[model samples]
Target: MPSADLLLTDTHIRTLDPAQPEVTALAVAGGRIVAVGDTDDLVRDWQGPGTERIDLAGAHVLPGLVDSHSHPVWGLEMATGVDLSGVVDLDGLRGALRTADRLGGWVVGWGLDHNAFEGRPIHRELIEDVLGGAPAFLRLYDGHSALVSGAALDAARITGPRSFDQRAEVVCDGEGRPTGYLVEHAAMDLVYEVAPRASDQDRRAGLVELLSTMAATGLTGAHVMDGSGLDLLAAVEEGADLPLRLTVSPWCMPGVDRAGLDELVALQKLGGRRWRVGGVKFFMDGTVEGGTAWLEHADCHGQGTDAFWPDPAAYSEAVRHLHAAGVRTATHAIGDAAVRHALDTIEALGESGRGAHRIEHIESVPDDTIPRFAALGVAASMQPPHTAYTKGDHSDEWSKRLGDARAARAWRTRDLRDAGAVLALGSDWPIAHYDARKVLAMARVPEGAAGPAQGLTGLEALEGVTSHAAIAAGQAAEGGRIAVGLRADLTVLGLDPVTAPADEVAEAPVVLTVTDGRITHRGA
Candidate 1:
């Protein structure tokens, strides 16, 4: 037997493997777990003069966390721009825009919520007043809508009201003049076309920084639910070694032709082990707060819109096409109607061993739809911290949009688990904090706070960010478990998460993180 490259000892390792649930030590070689067992035995057998040994000092180790769905590039890009997440009113909005104005360039901001405006509609005039006629574009927290100043509208050549096949609309005033608000991607693209894009250098730096930040939080892998896989490839091409593994999903929107599908399929084969395109992503409905989620009926009598696709049948056909091509499909479905439609589409494709078709943010679903997730083999990728954005008393914008009865069903993690669905958890970073501890904390106390009886057990919550998340990323066989042959990706914690109190688990510190046998982060 060859000597191992690295050896970790004096640790309580929770392997997540039923065969060898617990071990005292593990040996890594060639970026994979070569052996795991009694610390003394492995040390004596595997250690060599060239091997490096680390003492964990009785820390608890588990498989490194995997964020099943996140927007790494988007988050990093937003970090460089003004963050409007703190804006609570029109004054705050103006203040943020004013701050951005001082920074110069095309003033870009994100995380604005209309609910914070106290029922006042966001007008171009309001933004123009702050920018002093400078072009500025701000996106809502939901990412489904945007507010652009008159200067930006002129730059984008957006004049009167325009129609889009994908249910996107440019809001118009009573006189049919364009409002600053734009709904859905089609509408938002007009602004993006005119807006200055981040330089390749900036994009590469952002990706590297974001991945490093993720590693510090004990994340060894992430399912990047964004459209910028090329940026990651560019970073790698520039000789930047990513800190963690990434399974990228290209954003696939409605009206995509066969050529567009081919482009995505080509992107899938671009990267090596550190990053790869795992699947295609779609948005079925917008969001509850945006009044774009396809609910059973209109919440608050708003007449919630139709699916994002111009033709519902065409959307199904697209899923079927991808499923047939051996590619996984992940659809963002936050409302009951959208959830049903996503499930129905996946079910229509029949069974296959290709990939795990999933629904991101199954925030609201009918009771019957829960069981179908398991029956249909659809992975439920959800973020628990998203609930923290809501008020516990159901007075939050999202809750009010959902009403009383449906509001109680927000993020039904336990119900989905009880119904035998595969629940994969994530942070959806930029929208919420990316720390795994906070996510676990929210998951532990979801009852009454996030949703009625939606809380999950400590072990279940752990699995959501570990094993289940790996499965959702289509790496079930190679990672997720701390078996002898699995990848050497591990997270060393201060205590045994499964045995500790939920609150304690949330506070537990991450002592170290290892990805592919390389120590990415270490804390004293």
Candidate 2:
């Protein structure tokens, strides 16, 4: 028998395997687990003169975590921009812009929440004054709306009202003049087209930094749900050795034709050990806070729009086409109506036979709609940390728009689990913090924050980020477990999360992270 390349011993390992749930030691070779057994026994039999044996000193180990839905590229780009998540009022907003202006170049900021402004109307004049005539664009926390300075508006050549297929509106003053606020991607893209883009080098550096951070936070894999697959591929080709495995999902926007579908299908040909274009992403509706999600009815007399595809039948047909082509689909569906539409489309497809389809951000679902997820074998990709942005007292914009009853049903993770749905949790990074520990912590105590009675048990929450997450990404066969022959991706924590107190679980440090038999992160 070949000697193992590395041996990890003297640890408490939770394999998440029913047959052998716990083990003290494991051996890795050629990027895969070769054996797992008693520490002394494995060391005696598998350890070699050349083997690298690391004593874990009783640290707890589990399968390396998988974030079922995230936007790593977007997160990195946001990092380069001014972070307005901490700004509270108009003064704070102005201060943030001023600081960003000092950084030089075009001023761009994200994570501005209008709810924090105490109902102060955002206008072009206000932003123009802050930057002193500099070109600036500030995106709301939801990523569904943005405010631009007058210079930015001019740069984009937006002087009048514009229409979009996706219900986006360039807010207009009574005189039909464009306000600074832009809603949804269609409107936001106008400014982005003129905004200075991060250079390839900048993106490469940012991605490397982001991956290292993810490894430290206990993530060995992520399902990247955005249009940056090509960028990731380029980064890898440029000799950036990413620490985590990535399954990229290229964005498949509404109105895509057969040729577009074929283009997306071709992306599947690009696959390597570290990355693969595993699926296509679609936005069924916009965010609730943006007043664009396809709610059951108008929220407080605000008529939410139709699906992004404009024609519901066309959206369903697109899903059918993709499903027929053996491509997995993950639709961003926040409102109950949007979630139902996605679920209905998947159900109508009647089993793609390739992999499980997914619904991203089922933020609001009717009770009856919960069971359909399991019934249709759709994975529920959710982010518990997103609830942190809300007050839970019905004062936040989302809750106020959703009203008391619907708000109570936000992110029904437990209910979905109860209905036998596969729960795959993530941070949706750039929207929320990407730490797996924080996600686990939030899932375990989501009551009041996300919604009453929405919390999961500690074990269940852990599974959401591990086994279930892997299942969602279609990697359960080769990863997500500590069985022999599975990829040697593991996260060593300071304590056993299952048996530890909630605080301990939340605060437990990642002592080490191993992916493909290689130690990606190690801490004393």
Candidate 3:
């Protein structure tokens, strides 16, 4: 084993730098890499009395996984929440609800799948029966919609199920009664508010849970979305012993205007001290499964998809606002329309350097819009796992809505890369489990376990999770690779990434994670 300033040898390491892609030895001193080269040669020549020497026996070591996007802290809460991923019908729901707690306020549970229900919607009456006194809110795995008890509507002050507008999609029955289902942004927000909000303590504890689970999954860094960015920073500073480095990319909903942008700017200025505020996050459209995702083409299922834009014109201004104020922008655009709208917002920059505007999800980026992204200098912040996402049997009906060709482009890492778009990978945590290797495997698996033509090489996929992700964040100097003078943040995997098989990636243990020379996590 090498000392704090040790020389680890006999290692096939992917430096992940274009100039020099491979190195046998990686030298760490004072946390930042001091040197990297032939272990035998360096040892024979530069080895010092204090330099600890360790043997790798030719294992493949690469830079630690820098999860480009995820809400690690937020994921912790969801993980602790009820596991409703497989409940399809009321029979399954009741069986699981035997343990459902009567939390006094809103008895909230998440990760329910509508694919299991008839018409793909959970009836509101069923929820009300189980949730007698208080309101109850349950979220779908994608976080796009919620199933609420009738009590939830009263808590929110909705007089009748009919009172709610079309956007909310309260799911009225044939008799115009509340059906217990909510869809799109309206349902997402309305039902979310009904759920118990995480208090400061709850948030802090979530971080603790988040960091532990993240480290266990071979992740060393993450970009947290949706949750309060400022609160995360405060929690990080409050002595939260999270091994994972944090990048807070909090949500900036439309209700937030110029005044709010100013506050965000102030927060951004203060960010990057310890943990960083990676970019400005905003919702441009809704989720597809929830029927909120904007559509240029009609739903193939004959049912219309939601293309509701929240103040479209203001988006360009908002893009410029974040850029002019000097905060990077990452917008959540699940639909093709949202993706196009966001790109158009960036294109409006028109000779103004707004930095890299990120287009989240890109589930259905049209071919024309694909090439324009690079020309427009926008990074496609996409989910690589969705490469395998559509393969699930439950997605067949949703696939019917997407048609065929467009649906196949779910995780277009290679296309985005070939189009000259910078590709940054994320799990869209909670939407899909936040597993870095799964992202890598999906990127290479092409068909993501479905289409052989779409699979990428391991290296191409690894880059999406590493250096490329670093470049997207405009932190080329501080991140994505193991190099001299760069901050000493590295992950020591038990196996070498260069040769580690896909089956082994997800389970590959991280032996040690060194952040600034301190071993934050160690697993044998």
| lDDT comparing candidate 3 with the true structure | 0.68
lDDT of 2 by residue, 1-524 (tens): 67889999998889999999999999999999999989999988899988999898868889998888888877676555888989888888878887775334688888888676666566877767768778888888887889888888998999999976656889999999887989888898998888887777777776887888889988998999986746565656567567888889988876688899889888877877688888989888888877888888778547575666688787788778877887888999999889988888887776563246899999878889988888888999999888877777878777887788888788889899999989999988888778888888888777444764788887888899888988887889999889999999999999887777766777788899998888899976
TM-score of each: 0.95, 0.96, 0.88
Model 2: worst 10 consecutive residues (lDDT sum): 229-238
Task: Write the residue-wise lDDT of candidate 3 on 333-367 in tens digits.
Answer: 87787788888888877756534667778776667
Most lDDT-accurate candidate: 2
Candidate 3, residue 277: the lDDT equals 67
How far out, in Å, is residue 58 in model 2?
2.2
Model 1 lDDT-worst window of ten: 229-238
Off by over 4 Å in 2: 102-104, 352-355, 447-449
After TM-score superposition, what is the CA distance of residue 496 in candidate 1 from its true location, in Å? Answer: 2.5
TM-score of 2: 0.96
Candidate rank order under TM-score? 2, 1, 3
Score residue 228 of candidate 1 by CA lDDT: 66
Mark the 10 consecutive residues where model 3 has the least summed lDDT: 158-167
Tell me which of candidates 1 and 3 scores higher on lDDT: 1
